[model samples]
Target: MSAEFERDGTAWISASTGTRWVPVIGLEVHAQLATQSKLFCACEVRFGAPPNTLTCPICTGQPGTLPVLNATAVELAVRVALAVGAEVAAESKFDRKNYFYCDIPKNFQISQFDRPYCTGGGIQLPSGRFVRLTRIHIEEDAGKAIHDRGDETLVDLNRAGVALIESVSEADMESPEEAVEYLEALKEIIRYVGAGEADMEKGQLRCDVNVSVRPQGEPWRTKVEIKNLNSFRNAREALEYEIPRQIEAYESGDETRFPRQETRLFDVRAGVTRTMRSKEGASDYRYFAEPDLPPLALSESFVERQRGLLCELPEARRRRYREELGLSEYDARVLTAVREVADWFEAAARLSGRPKETANWIANDVLGGLADPKIEATSIDELPLKPFDLAELIALVAEGTLHSTGAREVMGEMLRTGAAPRALVAERGLEQVEDEGRLEVWCREALEGREQVVADVRAGRIKALGAAVGPVMKASAGKANPRRVREILLRIIGEDE
Candidate 1:
């Protein structure tokens, strides 16, 4: 068998015939719509609301109750479809996917089957590789089944009848890393459109990955589906384990051990995929048009309206930041990582007319402050500090009215109390003292007994001046303008020379 070492040093061997096996990967990502109500009812769409409390007659599938679609959910799904450049259909229909699961009180999920709302768009990786999409279908989520609590399984129907959009990708990914990149990009778009939070931890977004391995020029093999991977790391780990297991199975020439069309669950603890059940095809689920809900017909105007509402996506924003603001790629990526943070930075940048400095301050000071545990506000929106105030702070530093260290202190006070940056600088006595005479005294005192540093500075090793400036700034209580201090030190060394 042919074997090669992965970057992490894991050995991946091909079949016994020395045939190189390439993994084919596809993903179905289900994102919960960020609507206020369930798909077909007015029950509040909430997470962690004491299980089953969010359910109502329509959501619970009472015998006489009929489903009335939530308009907001459809709009949210349309937003995602438009964001991804999917072709939104003029007409689509909901079908009953017949299944008997306790979590699904309806015994059949109302989902779009043949006539999904949108199709034919894909996510582009950072490498410019496009992972083509097959289709995106609208559906309702089933409730959670808690199987870990003893023998008697408990069902939480709070999530029942929640609106979801399942975006199915083609088998366009060959490696786990590409799959993850695609997922992250998709999630970013989803959040950008306000379609969903797409947080994996709260099950707002979940993925099902199908994988198979085949010889380089062979037809596709039987793909096995790994279900309900809550995080990207789990998806990658599962694929890492499964691809090799399937290759080893095929290599052994054991018919029973060959990869089959089946559903599996990721055993996160063991880092393996265990068979959940045989895969069910469309014929098995017995999908049929739901008699209660008629086919959804959308006007061209509605589609255009959603298209008009499309904001600049993260990729385009990153490009703009790089081209217009002269920011490094890393800075552009960090600024656009979140919509709120990007908006905040843009506002600050506009006010200060200093894009690079504003970006740096937001990246280092604002984001770092938000990440602190002591900061009650987790999001930029929650903070009382305004972007304009941050702009003013950046301007102060750029104007040499405040040094970076003093600006940082002012920023901390601004974050804590939403006070003006200038006021904080004044109140805390943090303004830089640029007086030539005063700074010279501190510089002269710092140069004392540091003859080697002075000698180096005199010999044209100007960087040695940094060694003397620290004690000068310390003596000046951090209020001395460091640039002016440097100039004074240079002049003193020149006079002595």
Candidate 2:
């Protein structure tokens, strides 16, 4: 592949034996806010609530039923903006996007067009590149259309007026990897802030991809907007399909045949972008300021108050885990991947007073066993072995009172029987055997029995050391401190002074 294809913000396309290039991808993702009520109505925003059972007069578009803004929804949007490092505008307003659809009872969506609530933010990927955010606007979602198998379309007013945030980004992305990273980062920030569930499987988060390509050092070509991509795989597939199709058309010397200013749908199963309709510009919507609701006015003091309530975002928390707690990058990423897991780690760390040890066990043992549903039912707070109990077990290993292998057995027993760590260790006689005399006798006998391993050890074969330790541990039934066993064996074999 050419360096131009690798770094010039273009998608590399391989055809048979050759490669082509396409440039510049951007995405717009809409995440539904997690407010209990709809954006402009009192109707409950509960999912799966028997079709239109949650609808009210205002949401159903009854005459003389005026809409009211949900304060919680507005606050949630602002919180999400703050989490993503967006600037909160002191004043923003809504507009009417006129359209006709079976799902939209009002025939117009209340959205922000000219001015949005927040703007100018960015999300950094693990690769250290930033995808600049253009704006995050507040809007009201339309209703849902349930089409029956018999060609009958039923409208459900339940989803009407639901709060949603339209997160638009600048065309700064260069590849599908960057796109996925941006989406992951955005989802993490939103999840941390309690803004929305952002589950693409549930349609709570939807993404539309905008892609255009041009030769290196040239201006971009006409862009095509692909809509209704539900998953990250579909997003990448859509871009992949579109980039080649456009390049093929352009290369055929048919500029007029290429897609011009149109909306397209990604056929996930077929892996292609199909024409939906001619894309409508903002002017086509005849957007005008909403007449009913007053402009949303937020005070600087109010924005500062919201900022004060913001929690440390995932990136910052991950950095603290690495810098302050001295955790490995992989460990830090695993712990801070979810807000709940991060909280669990912090609480366990504090209680254990052994941050690294607690993190290790949580990452290895606790998380490994999380698949058992019965174990999952017990909250971390209610676990039989408290963080301190595990800390005590770790202390034993660190102090050479218990072998690392013995500590593991004690931990397994603690999980199964809910017994105290120290008590279990005592009752089972699982303490490390560190007596110099006792270990020396065992080592000498082992050296006589395994003459070949003893010969190799004397010949400076360090790998044969494990050959000796393995039998010693087996003879001790896994109770001997491994470090002491190694020390005694080395002294007898003359490998130690």
Candidate 3:
């Protein structure tokens, strides 16, 4: 029953053998806590600032400096822990994880070792699969080392003491797709709770993948760690490449070709994983409690206070949108993708009392307008228009005060000038004319020279009604209520019958 492995494009095939291999996957995600100051000092915490400008003595690890914990950082971290349903500890302390990377100013990271602040929570995928968490510990990030400039490696210390929470998940994921789902779920919760902006592009969220492959119904084998995966695509692609690479090595029965327990980096250009360094054990870090910083003691009331700050999470909001608002699945999902946009939409929906129509405006108009090069804002929060204005605009359209086309014009002007919807409608002469007499005149004028179109309408060919509606709209300069024009044309034709 022995066979060799062959490369079948992206998948590895077992030649003449029915061998099934499964990958055990987990992720260690480091999310930067949203805070104004560094973890242990008063230095400002910002991205893309000049290098070495945000460092102080405590963050830089000077001989006589002491690290003071940031209360805001702890508050933000606790909010995330609560959002994920993690159990926060009553007392947790920081330990010095001894490492000697050039980015570490102290040659040791102040981190949680034996006692992390929270434990035992998980994220549920859209498919209802729960990826469990092992622990979430608070730590400080190291500085960046730039090596792309010729042969010289440069160091930037601005990020040295930025607060971070490292959430280590259990090996519960069976596939790369599930791993990405877990990451996206985690990022949503992080942003929803105002804990952090988990933007991977700006280094706010970084991930490390630990994966091992073994034959089905076998015990776990030595796992390889894939680092430097900044994007979810890289994470999935790395796993796709590493899993088969390991399986092929084992099927070859070459002891020397077998995978080792080491860290590797994903080469995005080559679409393969390269060896980084041998994976170190916990003993290699030489963990020790920090003598300067005291143990963090949290009161139950304080924990409860942070819990109150959490709003409806994305999943709950999405469910509510579907159940209460009667929105379609696509609309529910799109509206809840961003917390700010979702909140704006909820406010507009409540104001307009037209949840479905409000969702349409947000999905079809507001979000669509953001793609315009003329709009400087990337998100709803940055736009000049408000929820109240959107609600007014939606109401105008729903009540027949503005035709859909006129409403869109008014919305465009509102976006450009931040003016009231009614003002924009009046100033642009975009209001729909619903005066019965005026509408009948335009409808009759449209049907005057189109006897065949009028006869088709009389014969109940509803599709031909567009011919009459088009002229009425054009004669009124696109300010006629289209529905009313269609009704008037039908009434006039029926009266002549």
Candidate 1 lDDT over 1-497, as tens digits, reads 13332333122434346566788999999999999888998899888899889998898889999999988888888888888878999999999999998999989999999999899888888766789889999899999999999999899999999999999999989888888999999999999888999999999999999999886768999999999899999999999888888887887789999999999999999999999999999899999999999899989999888888888999899999999889999999899888999989898899999999989888888888898777789899888788999988988898889998998888888887899988888888888997888898888899999999999987889888899999999999999988888888888888987
> Over all chains combined, what TM-score does candidate 3 have?
0.90
* Candidate 2 residue lDDT tens string, 403-428: 87878888887765567787888998
Residue 116, candidate 2: how far off, in angstroms?
1.2
Model 1 stretches with alpha carbons more than 4 Å out: 1-4, 7-19
- Tens digits of per-residue lDDT, candidate 3, 43-138, equal 998999988989888888999999999999999999999988899999999999998888998999999999899998888788678888999999
Q: Of the pair 2 and 3, which is ahead by lDDT?
A: 3
**CA lDDT of 495 in candidate 3?**
92
Model 3 stretches astray by more than 4 angstroms? 1-18, 435-461, 488-497
lDDT scores for all predictions?
0.89, 0.81, 0.89
Name the lDDT value of residue 463 in candidate 3. 91
Candidate 2 — which pairs collide? none
